[model samples]
Structures are given as C-alpha cells and as structure tokens.
Target: MEQSHQALSSKSEAFIEKENKYGAHNYHPLPVVLEKGEGVYVWDVDGKKYYDFLSAYSAVNQGHCHPKIVGAMVKQAQTLTLTSRAFYNDQLGPYEEFVTEYFGFDKVLPMNTGAEAVETALKICRKWAYEVKGIPENQAQIIVCENNFHGRTTTIISFSNDENARKSFGPFTAGFIKIPYDDIEALENALKSTNNIAGFLVEPIQGEAGVYVPADGYLAKAKALCEQYNALFIADEVQTGIARTGKLLAVHHENVQPDILILGKAISGGVYPVSAVLANNAVMNVIKPGQHGSTFGGNPVAAAVAIAALEVVRDENLSQNAAYLGVVLRTGLNEIASRNPLITLVRGKGLLNAIVINCDEDSDLAWDICMKFSEYGLLAKPTHGNKIRLAPPLVITETQIHECLGIIERALNDFR
Candidate 1:
C-alpha cells in the first residue's frame, strides 16, 4: 500500500496500547508504530511515509519485503517447510552448499536466530578447545569484549558489561573473560595469560554499542594473536556480516578469516529467522551428533530463503554500494556535525553508522532528537542513551540517501 501523508492517528495509538498491555516490555521501541515496509521505507498505521534508517537493525540490507527473497520463501513454504534434521530435506543440502561456498567456509551449521548461532559457536569453540586443544573440560575460557552486545541469551550475558542486560539476570554463567575492545595489547595479554583459552569471540564492528567501529587492523591482529596462542578466532558477524560493512564480513577489511564464523539477521534478508555458524573440519567436527541441534534449524523454508537472500547480496553488488555510500554518508554526517553543536560526533563504516549527541549518556536528549526525527519523516533509534544509530538498508540509492541526509540535517537543526 502507498504511504499517505497522515499523522499517527488513534489507529496507531491503539496498536501500541494493545502491545504494551499484553507483550513483555523487554524492548523500548520508537513511538512510531510501523505497519508496512517496502525498500528503505516504512509506514505507520496512518500511512505516513518515513525512511527506514534502522533497517530492522541492519537485517533488511536486502531491503524490506524483497520480491526475489519472498518469492523463494513462498515457493518453498508451499512445497516443504520443515522435515527436521532427523530426516533430510531437499533445500537444506543445497543451502548448506551455497552458503558455505559463498562465505568460503568448509562447513555450516544452521540455527534460527543470532543468539542461538552465537551459543552454537561458543559450544563449538569450547568443545574444540577440550577435544582438540587439550584444555581440561570446563576450564576452557572464551574472551569477549566490554560493551559487546552479542545477544540476550543467558550464556552471552555472562560476559557482558551492560547493566540493563545484566541487572538481576545472574549469578551469570562463567568460563569467560571480558576485555577492552580494539585493544591489541589487552587481547594479547588475555591470550598469553592462559593455556585453557578456547577462543576470542568478537564483533568486527560493535553494532549495538552505538556502531562503534574498531581501530583499523584490530581484527587482523586479534586473529593473529589467537593463532599464536593456539586458540580459535571466532568472529560474531551476526550484525556486521553479509556486506553490511562494505565487505561480506567486516574482518575482510583486513583480509582476516575467522576460525569460527557466526552469522544471523540479514542471512535470510530479515524475512525469516535464520542464523549459521561456519567453520572448517578441525573445529566443526568436534561437535558430534546429538551434541548440538535445533529443531527449526536448517528447515527447508529457511534454507530456501537464505540462499535467495545471499544471492541478492551478490547480484546487487551491495558491498560495493555500501563501500561507496559509506564514504558519502560519513562525509555528509561529518559536515552536519561540524555545523550542528547538538551532534558531537559521527562514526561508522558502510551503512552501520551512529552520531553522538552532545549530552551525557544519562541524558534523554538523543531520544528526544529521535522523536523530532520521526516528526520529520525518518526513523532511527538511540543506543547507549546519547547516541543514535543510522544504519539504513544497503539497497538505498544515492538520491534517497541525500534526501535522508536532508531529513537528518533538518532534525539536527530543530534541536539547535
């Protein structure tokens, strides 16, 4: 349906109220109640057109409701949706072959969401450390970064420093160490400090912590340190993978390949819940049958959707577009920051970008700015209290991006 130039009416308010009434208040969503999305745009129930600056947290890099991906999904769903890993399904084998080859991995294990895939990779790493690296069972330690947002899973939250995610959630799980991100010295110290180190799991670019792009060569150096210490270099590319950072994987920026790669979000173009963990024989073979499995993982419909989603990335040359547009976006945002005192900083790679508001982290100024942005026909979210992430779909055209930049500039001006 085409977007009509209307305000959020009682219709939108009703939906929000209904959700607040019944649903768990786990998420603090922007007040805009999205009802429909197409390309890089979303519409509320009242049919107001707004540029989708978030891209469902970079899941719709292929763009929302893409026809090719949806078509593949529909065809598969009509034929066979699930047969379980107990019985082979036609789509699973082909998808495994396609995705493994596409990402240049020797093998792939599928799961349904980002957190599940992360858990799966952790299992593979610890098992590899015990069975192969000869670490005593239950003593293997995985290194994570401070301010990393892997997921809400209990095991992941064990190593996290985020108070909101960790508050009252534990007695958290152990066997993990947290380190400062983008610090090569910290990584090396952690690695050399212990013999029972299983792996170093990290995001190529920390997306949730306000799109914090690490220093150049951090990933490469970290991976090399892991190799030197005989530990796995696991890259959690769930948010930064699949051409989101102008490379198929953010580590590609430094020509580093991970020992274990975890992916989700855009893997299925955000049309379905699909995640994958890719590794070579040495690491992956550690997990035997019944050691780990997901009933919904590798289902036929997911297989079909993932294959199509990946194809769209290649066919559209999204990596190149993102690379070029990233330069344009950062340049533009930098210019805006120069003129707008409200915007203290702008930083990111490709479409995954953020602007720091000139306020304390505890201040709600960033949230208030987002409300003004919504009024001006753009949708973005504040992270870390005083930073707003601006990752739109990679499929956005230069013209549309400039238009959105105008909206952003105007929104910043309003704050002045």
Candidate 2:
C-alpha cells in the first residue's frame, strides 16, 4: 500500500511528529496534513486538494468556512462573545426563537457539542420521567440500540455496545436497555419490559454504525410504541440532522416528531461548536433555574452562527439538493458495485451513505482503501473497520459529486 501513494511530505511529517510528541493518542486519523478547507474541498499543507467526503463527520453540511456562518460567528465575536445563562444576551433570545420556530418546537436548550446535546436530552428525559411521567426516582430507564454511537462521554459510553470504548471505562451507567436497531418488536418488548421506562434514545439513522438507515416506518412505529407505553421518543439527530439525510431531519421522512430532539454539527455550519435539545413546554418545563446549563452553551457566537447556518440550509434548499443528489450518488455507487466485487454493499439515506467492503470487520481493507482515496485527491474514512462513510458537505454540486465518484472508481480500480 505504501507503494501506491507518495511518501508523507517533510512538513506533513513534522506536523504528525509534533502531534505524536505532545498530543494524546486518542484518534488514529488518516495520515494527511490538512491545513485549509473551502466549500466541498480541503487542501493538505502541501497543497494537494481533495473532495471532503467525510465533511468533518457531517459537521460541515453547509460546507467548510461558509461565509455566512463564519461571518455570523466573527460578527458576534466582535460584538459580544460570552454572556452565560446567568445573564441573558441579545443573541440567545433570537436564537431560541428562531431555532424553536425552525424545528417546530416549543423550547430549546442550547449546548456546545453533539454529546453535550445528548447528555442534555438524557437529563431532560430523566427529569421529565420523574416529574411528569411519575416514574420512580433513580429507576427510570432509557432504551438504546445496539451498535449505536451517540458520543464518547462517560454516561454516553455506558450504554454503548462497542467494547473498545467500554473497556476500562468501568462501572457503566445503569438504567439503559440495549435493543437491535430497526427492530420494532425489540422496541415494543423493551418498552413493555418496564413501567419506569423514561424514554427511548435513538439515532434516527445510526451514522457511526456504518450509516445504518433503518427500515421504512421504523421511526414512526418506534414513536407509536413510545406513545403506547407513554415513554418519550428521544431522537438523536446530532449526526443525521440538518439536511445530511435528505430531510430537515431523518424523522421528517416518517412524519414523526421526537419528544426530545437533539441537534448539533451542521447547526453551526462547522464553524463553531453548537448543539441543542428541543422539546415542548410540558416536557421541558421540568427543569427549574440552576438545574442545568453550560457557561458557553448559549453564547452569542454560537447563536449567531447557528442562525446563519440554518438559514443557509433553508435558503440553499440543502434538503432538496441532498435528496436529488442522493439518488445520483447511490445509482453511481450501485453501478460501481455491480462491476466491483470488493464493494459488497451500499446503503444509506441522502448525503449520508456508506459502502461496505467485502472483508471482515477486523480487516484493514477499508482503511487501506481510504488511504488510496486520499492519495487520489478524495478524502473519506472507515468506520467499524470495513465501511467507508461517504458524506460530503451538502453544498457539494453535481459536477463535484461526479468528480468525486470518478476518483472513487479510479481508486477502486487500483485496488483491483
């Protein structure tokens, strides 16, 4: 595989060496030295540009360094940066109004990252269960799917099935029941398993689990089951929201609204860390003052950036673009799959998609394939060992999409 690509430039080696010397060995990022990004492309320090297929794990749905989002952040930073929930700022009220209205929710609790939004949602659900749902204190349970990837926080990882994440994490948080993804029967059974069930926290489409889009009506049926059992259906749209999945949210495809809606990533157009959990007053009202918040959660910069980012999604019709281009991308992929035995399966929704390489989960074939992709001027990454997630920024045009597909095809041919 080393013969297939050029050696790392000295500048790249220096940056990598610095990180290895000073940074924690947490992430095994692809050996590339990216220094710049604009729209759908990112340039390495050595100036080799590549299509940004990963999109910062779908955080840059509005594309990289979007003028509107960056402009909003910069404009807000210059005017006002931080006024915590202790003191209200001009940006927070408008952001609350706009976000609640945009997502058709009664209220929103803003946060700074996807995991924080998820953690916020869990706290809200548990609080609501105890306060409103009449669940016994300290006994409320939330159901999660197997092979889920909500985040890396201690509480979040407690329910995760991935052993590597759970190893040495110790004394996992209790009160979470695990079930299979896309299984309505498993959901009903779990809901029936406990009267103290607080909610069912789920990813509308399990992105980190290799873009595992569920069956049609799985979300709607799950919501109905939640209603049947009086458990809140919390949809973690942190990765699947903001037009990455062809709809405003993946749940929109099924016309099901989550009791607690968690959003992050593209909410700030990848320029700032912004996340939020939205729910109606009845559920959100459980929290009193000083109950939960972050110092920078509702900062002016996040609010301004999120407003602009969401507006860009609406004005640019990112949802429509994703829906149309999804068909194009998938059709091209299926054609490639038909001719290539190496690619075993293609499945996903909208811009969030993946191709399963014909290898075991422990195999490094997908990682090596991704390395070849990087060498060919296209950037992508492997998840769960054998799946190459192919989500580019929603701002990517059709010509760019075709160009990326060509790169992928040529790169796969090299493997052949």
Candidate 3:
C-alpha cells in the first residue's frame, strides 16, 4: 500500500506536468504542487511542509479539511447529495434558516461561486429598482468602486477598471457607475446626482485588489447614504466574510448592515462551492420564480455543508480568534516593514493582510519573497504584482501565528 501511494504521488506530478503543457495559461501560480492539507498547513508533492498563509484566497478560513465540515460532507454524501430546486429537499430550508440567522438576513438565494453571487446581487438590484423603487426598465444604475475585484463573469468584469480584466470584454454591460474606493465624497456625489440608481455594490475590503481596506466610518456613512437615497447597499463580503476579517462580517466593524449581502468561499469551510445572496423580502422577492438560479444552487450537499461550516465559526469563536491574531500578525509585519526598505507598506485588518514591495508591478520581487517564504516553510501568493496577501485561516492559534511570523521574518532577511 505504501509503494502504491508513492506511485500515485509520482503520477500526480506527471499529471501536473501535463496540465501545464496542455491547460490554458490563465493563472501563473507558484511552482509548488500541493498534495495534502490539514489545519493551517499543506504538504507539497515532494513532502515539504509549508504554513498556508494565503488560506486558498481566504476560502479555507475554518482551516483546511476541518473535520466537522468534512464529516458533515461525508455523512450527507453517503445519504443524499444533490436534489435540484426543481424538487424540494430536506436540507435546504434548515440550512437557509441557519445561514440567514447567522448573518442577520431575512432570506437567502444560494449560488455556486462568488461571481454567481455577485451576478445574483446585480440582477436583484436591477429588478428591485424597476419593481420596488419604480425605476424605468434598463435605466437602473449600480454604483461600484474603482479597483474593485468582485468576480470574473462577463457582466461583473464589465464594471472592472483593471485593464487585464476589462480589455476586449466589450461592449460591456451598462448601468454601473464607478467611484474611487475610500472616498466618501465621490460616493456622495454620485448618489446625490443619480436618480435611477438601484444599489451601491462594493467589497468592504477589496481582497483581490491587494486587500485595500476603506477608511474608518466609510461603510457606516455609505450605508447611511444608501438609505437616504433609497438605494440598496450591496456588500460583496465573499472574501472577507465568514470571520476572515476578525468580525463575522467586515461591515460589522462600522456597525453597518448592507441591504444585500453576498457571501461565498469559506461558507463551506473550503469543503465545497457554496455562495449566497442575502436580503430582506422586499429586495429578494423582486425575483419571482424562474428569474434566476443555478442547477447546483441550493443543492442538498451544499446546504448541509454550509450549515456545518457556519456553525463552526460560531462554536469555535473564529471571529474573535482572527481579531486577536490579526493584531499580532499585522504588528509583527509592520515592525518588519519599518526595518526593511524592500517592504514599503504592511496594511490590513483581521487575518486579511498584505505587504507592498518597493518594486515595479511586473517585477519578480514579490515572487522571490514568496519562494523564500516557502523555503522558510510559509506559503503565500502575490496579488497584482508586487503585493503579497497574507491571510491565514481564522482557526490558526497564537502559537502557530508566532511560528509563522518567525518564518516570515526569516524570509524577509533571506530575501535581503
């Protein structure tokens, strides 16, 4: 059995080689072939271990292969997995109730990916504009932020200002107004001037845009403005929600509740693809039957998995854990940044943090630092070019955090 396992590992490497040779060149990942993962760590195909600082882009916030989440998945799979919305399932209602209550929403529309959730929100906003807000059809506008990384769908990418994401993806979807992030004035100006606006969609913290956190009170003021204008406030917390940002949701930091909440990634604790669009009945009921849905959306297995995943966050107090350790990790990084000229800035909240490299966006400096981090047994990824996002699982312990910090410090010194 041991020899057969070794042969399987060798075959996996060969498969990876074939993938690089044949697959689309869309993603330029680091040269590490991960084979297995546990809490806060992953082992490469070569049996080398590394701390997982990226946390699967904050998908594995409950840590990799959490036994509870996986166990739920196993039990459900053995019993029942998929029952499309065409028929009622036993798991969907209970899971919906659990998730809606967890996030303080009245209803939830399930989807399979972050982009689908964003797309769902957009559709809901537009429908609500016409039906609820009495806006003319095809004239409802949604406000977005500059440098926002919502998702990669055609309609979602249409509002993206990133050239790589937007180039040649036209003629784009209309009805979106773009504003600078962290600037309340721009949002206020847009909101004041626009009458047919349906909603304001934003990432509380721009995760894929290198973890750009908005200014203090930005969300609070923005939600207020949306209320004043009678427009829906849609928050794309797909990357920052489910306790990734110390709070159950990032908007909680400002005591703001969005009208429409988009959640994904860690909602399944990295066990499955489960995303949801949450809102009150007023906004959600705008979409009657046959308006929007996915074949796999709200499947029995996804519902079951998401309920267990969210329960873990509450039971384990992962939000409080992230809050405490985030300060420690950011402080450590900031201290290191002060001493290193190569590191221009270190900024983030909770477990979602990033270090900006003092080099060109296209430079390999960030990649070099990541490789060095791997050598020191910590794994992370570079977003954009010269920025590396450090988002460990919220389940990580303080001792593990310090150990990871030691690895990061060594990587910084070694890179120098």
Candidate 4:
C-alpha cells in the first residue's frame, strides 16, 4: 500500500505535467513552477529564488505566507473552520467591524472571491434601484468602462470590451452601458441619457487591462456625477486597494469615497481566499436574509485571517511603503525609458504600475523580456500583449526595490 501511495504521488506530478499538455490553453503563464514563498520572494520547484513582482495579481500585498495571517488561520481552523449563515460565528462581527471601520463604510458583506464581491455589488445596486431609486424592476442599468475587467463570471464578463474574455461567454447578461474610461464627458452623456441607471462600476486603475490609470480628477468627477444623478458609484478595488496603490484605497487618492467598495485579493494576506463588499445601510440593507450569501463567506477562519491581515497593513505601514517605493520605481523606470525606445511609457500610481512596450501586440517581444526578467531573478507577467504590469508586495523594502530595479534594468537592456 505504501509503494502504491508513492506511485500515486508520482502520478500526481505526472498529472500536473499531463494537464498542462492537454488542458484548456487559456493562460500563457511564465514557465516557472513555484513551490514555496516567504516575504517578497518565491522559490521554484528546482529551489531557485526569484523576487515576486506581480504578487498574484496584487493578491499578496502583505507578502507570501505572512506570519500573523497564517497564525490567525491556524488558530481559527483549530477552533472552527465554517458555520454557514444558517448560524452565526463569533468571528464575523469583529471582522465586519474591523473592515468597515478601516474602509469607512457602515457595513460589509463578505464573500470568498473578488468576482463574488463584484456580483454582490451588482445585486445590491439592482435591488437598491428597485427598492430605493424606484427604477422599474429589470430595466436598471450600470455604467462600466472600456477595457474594464471585473472578473470571469458570466454576468461580469458581459460588460467586458475585451473580445477574448467576452467572445464565447454569451448570451451575456444585459442592462450595462460601456463608456470610454477616464472621459468625464462620456460618463456625463450616459448619465444624462439614462434615468434608470443604478450604478457606475469602475476600477480606479484598470489593472488587468494593462494597468491603465485614469486621468487626474476622473474618480472625483465621476463621484460627483453619480451623486447628482443619485446613482451609486461602485469602485472595484480588488487590485488597487489595501495599500497596493499607496493609499488604503485608490479612490482615496482623489478624495472620492465610493458608495459601494469591492475588495479581495490581499484581504487575507494571500493566505486564504477572502473578499468583501462595503457599503452604507441605504445600499447594503437592500440585501436581507436569504437574498444573497456564500457558504464560506465570513467563515471564522476567513474572518480571523482577514482581521490580522488588515492589522498588518496598518501596523506595518504598507501604504507608506508603497507610496515611497513607487516613487523610486517609477523614477527609475522613467530614467530607463529615456534611453530605451522600446519602452513607450511608464505610468501608474504607487506600486501599481506598467510599462508599455513599443512593439507589435502579437509579437514575442513582451514574452521574451519576461524570460529575461526571470533569468535575472525577478518575476513579472505581461498583460494583453505589449504591456507589463509591475506590482511587488507592499512589504518590499527600499533595498529590495533597488535590487529589483537592477534586475529590471538588466532585463530591459537585454531587450534593447
């Protein structure tokens, strides 16, 4: 039996090998097998070390295997793992309090993933449209942006302008309007044209769509428009919040508070899956008992882990770190861009930044540069085709930033 178990383990590794060979070829990921991680670095299956720059789509803002978050997870698991909404657990209330107070919201609805939180926000907006705004039942509309990426869910992808994400995923969900991002006039025109609009859903900086940063005052202007039209301004900060973008939330950079805030990724410091929707009573109260929920949402383990994760963001001053390091990284990249025509632009706020490669979208240029980066001991992935997003863990130190910069410079030089 023991020999059979060993054979099964070998089969497991072979299974991973075979799956990659014959599985759905959706993602073109960098060829690196991660086995373990700590702080701002990950080791491959071969035990080679590399600095993690993408942070699992900014999910590891607290770095990998954060001790406090892991401790909370372990302790909570020992006590109780899950008690569905059929009954309450002790951890939910305190977690709700911590997250709401931290983000300056009246209440929070926890979920297991960023996409679920986004769907919850949509439901809340629709319900509020019916109950509060008196928009006829199913005619309510939500405004989304061009190149905005909410998630992979059917309804979320319905509004996506990216052909790849939306192509084979329909008959899509309806009742959404798409506008040019960072353009206030487009948003105003949509608002003026529609009366049944319930919300404006946006990413402060469109992360998956190549780390696109909107124009200055774009968020504030949109917020004002939403207020004037009595529509909810929903910010999908799953990638831009929790100090990934200098501020705790990127909307705060413009002094604009979203009515419905969706967060995930780093909520549990990347130790576990945790996501949430934050809003005041007027919007959140629309979701009553049995209206919306997840079996593992706000489970004791997730709640405890998320609480510790948020505390780490505060006690460690990760926001400040991101802000400072962002300046250093951006300035460094700008200097490099001055010498290399291959780099068209370096743009972002805080640590959420990207470099636009001046090459054909379908060419191997971006992928080649990524390989060069991997060789230099830093890991980053290209978005779309000609853009590479760089978002290291918020816990990265100045020395680490400089070291990573050296690696990036070397890779850029190789590209040249």
Candidate 5:
C-alpha cells in the first residue's frame, strides 16, 4: 500500500511539474491533481480520493458535478446553446422569469462571471443614481468594505485593501468609499457625509477575508441605514449564497432584503459559469438597450443549468442542511480547539468557517496544515497566511461531516 501511494505521489508530482512549466504562475494550488469529483469527494489523477472542503471557494454548493445540474446543462447544450440577446431564444425568457421569481426580484441581468455581475451591478447603481436618484453623472460613489475580495477586475480592485491584489495595479477606477466591515457607525457616517452615494456593496460574511462573520444585527442595521439614505444596499453573495452560509442567501439570516443582489459561483451548481444581478424595475430599468450586455450571459445551457441548480437547492433542502451541519462542524472544531494550542480562534457562520492560527501573518503554518490535511484524504486551503477556510459542499451528510471532523482532529494532532 505504501509503495502504491508512493507511485501515485510520483505521478501527481509529474503532473504538478507539467502544470508549473506550462500554466500561468498565478495560482499556487495544492499538489494534488484532481481529475474527477462527485458529491463532496474528489479523486486525483491517481484515483486517490479526498473530501472537498473548499468547494471551489463555495462554488459547488450542490456538490461537484451534480447530476441534475449536469443533466440540465447536457440537455440544453444538445438543444440550443447560445443565441445572443439580439434574438429571443426559447430558454432565456423562462429562465429570467424563474430566477426572478425564485429570488423575489422584479428583473435580473445575467452575466458569465461573478466579476461581470459585480461590474454590472456597479454600472446599474451609478446609472440609477444619476438618472433616478438625481445624482450628477460620474459623481456616484459606492461604499465598499476594507479587505473586500469582490474579484480581479481593475474597477473592482480599485477599492480593495489587499496589498497583493492592489499593488502594481495602480490608476484604479475611482468613485468608491472604503469603510470598515461591520461598523454601522462608519456606514452611517459615510451616508450622512456623502451627497451622491449610489449604493453600499457588502458581503454578508466576508468569505475571502477568512470567513469573517460580522456582529449580529449589523446587516439589518446597515440595510436600514441604506434605506434611510435612499441608497441601494447591495449584497454580494457570490461566495456566501446558495446554502454555503446556511441560508439560501446570507442576508436572509437577518431577514433583510437587499435593494440589489449579486449572485454567482454556485448559481449553476459549479457546472458552469453563470452570474446575475437582481433588482426591482426602478433600478434595473435604468440601462437602455446597447448600454450593457454579455453575448453568452443568458444562453440556453446556463439558464437550464441555473434553474436545475436552484431547484436542487430547494428540493434537497440544502440551506436547512447547511444550517444544521454548520453547527456540527463548528462545535466539533471548537472542541478540538480547546485541546489544541495552535488554534487561537474558530469563527464563521454556517459551513463557511475558518480557524485562526496562533502564528504571525508571514507564517506558513496554515499552509503546512492544509498540506497535512491533504495527506490525510481531506482538502482545504489557507487564506491571509494564518487562517484556513473550511467550507464543504452543502450536500454533505452528518456522517460524512463527522468523519471529516475526525480527519481534521487527527491532522491537527499530527501537526501539534
């Protein structure tokens, strides 16, 4: 068994070397080379299996290669794939209606990636501010939180506080106000001080910022403030939506409806790249034809895949499952933390959880721990150098979650 594992490791190393040589040096992925996945499990090229803890940064909420989503995509692909918005395709209208109704929005603007949806939302908000809210053109200001991880676009990164993502990408697009996360006072102050505020974009849980769950009532209070100021409250649920944070949308945890909602990642159950921005007619209708569009945004396959993905979220009750299993995961991790000194704190909401390592920001302890976890047949990644985010697929069962907990503890014990 050891020899076979060694051979598999060699094969994996060869694949990694090839990728390093051929592929862009942008992502420093785990050494494992995965070729297939099902549910919460992924198999490497050598057929070694491991639990998928990251879920592609919460993209695969329905689990890897969900059959329903894949079936829908396959059927749609076979039928009709792309018909640019120039002509009406059969699937686009039904999908628009279904998604709008599912999320309680009057309309939706579809896009291909989370960044594109975010950009769309930003453009819409600015336009609405000038056209509807009576703000001057090019003077619209959108408030964003520090340590935000929206996407890699220049306009999006202009306001990001992450030095790695911001440095050397200067001359960023302006018209953004940066505020501290979870600070209602800062939010209110910005609203009061600003005359041309268009919208306040925020993440309910701050997934990429190490799953930083804000204080209770923060979102509710912030939404109230946005309403008070007549500014749009935009929820970026790209990472925290679709049962990843124990709710269909994390904002639902506060029972507050955002004026503008940006959704992506798991909207198609990780089967395809599909994103959308939803708003009422007053806000979404600001854009005229030829103002904004994506050629492959509302294609037939994406529409079918997204509908099936959302249906699975409802039929399988993934949100409730995530709510229940999140408690289990956090409780198990807390128990383990009590016995492990290396773990300083465990924080997050639902399955979107992370552990703060008792080490410096430059320390590689978290990365080392993830490598050890991979060795033990589980997969996770580190963020901010000293934190590791553990978010598995919502389709995970209690038994599988408990098994993962055992593996996590064993890995921690080995490291300790």
Candidate 6:
C-alpha cells in the first residue's frame, strides 16, 4: 500500500492562521514561523533563512538538530526509552555516574524539565534542613532573589516578583524570603536574621531578568555566607549551564561550588527534555526512596542523549569558543552601540549577551526593532520591553558571528 501526503506551501499566512486558531495563546512569539533549523540558522515556513540568535532560550546550546546528539537520541529511542524508575534501566546508573563526575557532584537526581529539577532542589533543600540541619518540620525557609525566573509552576512562581507571571496564580506558597539580586549584604543579613533557613537559591547570571550579571565576587561571597549559616547554596543553571556561558557552569566564573545545582535546557542538547539536580551526599541523602520520583525522569533515551550532549560540550571545546566569540560579539555590539543611539548598553558573559534599547520599558520600540531584525535575516526578541537577548548556538563560527553582527547593525540602523 502506498501512503500519500499533502504538500505544504512555503507561505506562512495559512500556517500562522492554523496556530492562532488552535494553539494556546500563552506565548506572544515573533510573527515568523520556523520550519527547519541547522546549526546557527533556521528557515521559516515561508522558506526565508535567518540566523538563530535565541538558541531556544539556551536549550540548543549545542545547535539545532546537532547530528551527534540526534544520532544518540535515535539509537537510544530504538533500544530503550523508559522504565519508570520503578525498575532501574541499564543506562540510568551509567548516566548518573557520568553526569555526577562531569559536574563534580557525588549524586544526580534526574528529571524531565528545568522546573521539575528546581522543584526537586527545593524539596531536597527543605528535607535536608529538617532532617540533617535539625530544623523543625514545616518551618524551613528558602531565600530567593527578586526578579528571578526559575520556572512557571505554582510554587516556583510564588516568590516571583513578575506581576504578569504571578498575578491571579496564587494564594502563593510561603516561607521564601525575597531579596534583591547581586546584593551580598542583603544575602548575609537574610542568613543572619533568619533561622530554619534551608537554602539560598540564585542564578549565577539572571538570564530572564534581562541577562543581569552579578557584581564580581558576589557568588563566591554568597556561597561563603551560606556556608557560615549552614544553608544550602542552590545554583539554578537551567538557562546558563552546559557551555552557554563560556564555562560548563556559570558559577565556575566565581570558583564557587553550589551546595546543590539545578540544571536543564541543554542537558540533552535540546534534543529531548532532560533536567537534573546534583549535590553531594550530605544534601542528597536526605531524600529516601518512595519520597521523590518521576516516571520518565531517568529513562534510557534521556540518559543516552544527555551523555552525548555532555560529550559534545567537552569534545567540541564549546566553552572556549563561546568565551572567544562572546568577547567578539560584545566588542562588535559595543562599537555598533557607539554609532547607533538606539542601543544604549551591551552586557552579558559568553554568548549569552543582550543590548538595551534606548527607550522606556513600556515603549514598543524594542518589539518593533525585533520585527526589523526579522526582516534583516537575524532573529532575536525583546526580553522585557527594551532589552533584547542575543544568544546564538555555541557551535556558531567566528565568521557567522561577524555576519550576524552586520545584520544586527543594519537592523538597528534601519529601525525608525
């Protein structure tokens, strides 16, 4: 029997109509609809090519549809996919060993999304506080920073300062102390002023808060303060880990090892959904069997994909490339900013960089600028209202980077 299929057109209007009619309206994505991607570039449904500057929010740090990562996933999908953690699969133990050793942690608890991994860390921190640190049950407090973007879950959003993410989503969870980001004094004071404090959760660089980088020595000092107060230092590297930040982990910039590390996004090179919580025995041991688990968390396919992804990070020397290219990117953008009055400031580390538009937060200038960028064959979007993050895949070449720089300059120049 022969199977037949309808040939789709390169025109984007009808496809966009289908999405608008049926898809959830949660995200206000750019008008362009991407249908294919390879390395640093993507093609729209209309067959227009553009540089992929966002990299799926750093999930595709290895690049779009990387052959090695996709190959590993295909092989594993053919072999074994899931066993539900009720019975261990062969790949689970090996992956646990590999990731733990790679990240210099004693153990790894696998999950399928960044939010789940964050929730896992939060649970571990609280349990360790109650059982190991001798805090009374139901009294553990975890400190979080303001303007943080951990995830969209109810409990995760409880401490979010973003009104849009939190509005009408609560009766929010309690026991989280909110303090300003990059403030060492505030963190130290919070630690000293509170008891039953389980952990201090932070992003090494606040990616969703418009790519806000902390002051020098802030992470190291904050970790020391957590040590002094016997609270866990939790680094949520969901968006900044896996060579996206010119290092395996952004916290490496400060030479600080977190008490518990939460990771996701590029863990499987964006080929599959995989996330993990890594910690030494003292913190991880608090979670007993039957207390915490997930159905597809440590599935064989996820294990294999993550292994190949981490291997790619190591084999490709992506961290070094990101470091070099980041400097080139920032320097290029800074020069462009000098000539163009619209781009106010450029900031970030590694490929995870952004340019601030010279406009008010409520203005449409940034969004309009992104539309201009799309027209100019470069794809990027505004983070808040006026800040646009430009993190391309780590595998992007130096030549392609400069080419994209030209596209950006043209976009800024042409924007009215």
Q: Which sections of candidate 3 miss by over 4 Å?
A: 1-13
lDDT for each candidate structure: 0.91, 0.93, 0.90, 0.91, 0.92, 0.92
lDDT of 2: 0.93
Residue 121 local lDDT, model 2 = 96
**Cα distance off (Å), candidate 5, residue 296:** 0.7
- Residues 1-416, candidate 4, lDDT per residue (tens digit)? 00101122343466467768999877766767778999999987667799999999999999999999999999999999988989988999999998999999999999999999999999999999999999998999999999989999999989887788888778999999999999999999999897999999999999987889888899999999999999999999999999988999999999999999999999889999999999999899888888999999999999999999999999999999999999999998998889888799999999999999998878777878887888778899998899999999999998998888888887887656
The residue ranges of model 6 lying beyond 4 angstroms of the native Cα positions read 1-10
Error of 1 at 84 (Å): 1.1
The C-alpha stretches of model 5 lying farther than 4 A from their native spots are: 1-8
Q: TM-score per candidate, in order?
A: 0.98, 0.99, 0.96, 0.95, 0.97, 0.97
lDDT of candidate 5 at residue 65, scale 0 to 100: 96
Instruction: List candidate 4 segments past 4 Å from native.
Output: 1-16, 21-24
CA RMSD, predictions in order: 3.1, 1.0, 4.4, 5.5, 2.4, 5.4
lDDT of 3: 0.90
lDDT of 1 by residue, 204-291 (tens): 9999899998988888889889989999999999999999999988999999999999999999999999999999988899888999
The best candidate in terms of TM-score: 2
In angstroms, give how far residue 50 of model 6 lies from its true place: 1.0
What value of lDDT does candidate 1 attain over all alpha carbons?
0.91
What range of 10 consecutive residues in model 2 has the weakest lDDT sum? 1-10
- The alpha-carbon deviation from the true structure for residue 251 of candidate 3, after best TM-score superposition, in angstroms, is 0.2
lDDT of 1 at 97: 96
lDDT of 3 by residue, 13-89 (tens): 68678878999887877667888999898998778888899998899999999999999999999998887889999
Error of 3 at 257 (Å): 0.9
Question: What pairs collide in candidate 2?
Answer: none
Per-residue lDDT of 312-361 in model 2, one digit per residue for the tens? Answer: 99999999999999889999999999998889999989999999999899
Q: Give the TM-score of candidate 1.
A: 0.98
Better of 1 and 4 by TM-score: 1
- Name model 1 segments beyond 4 Å from true: 1-8
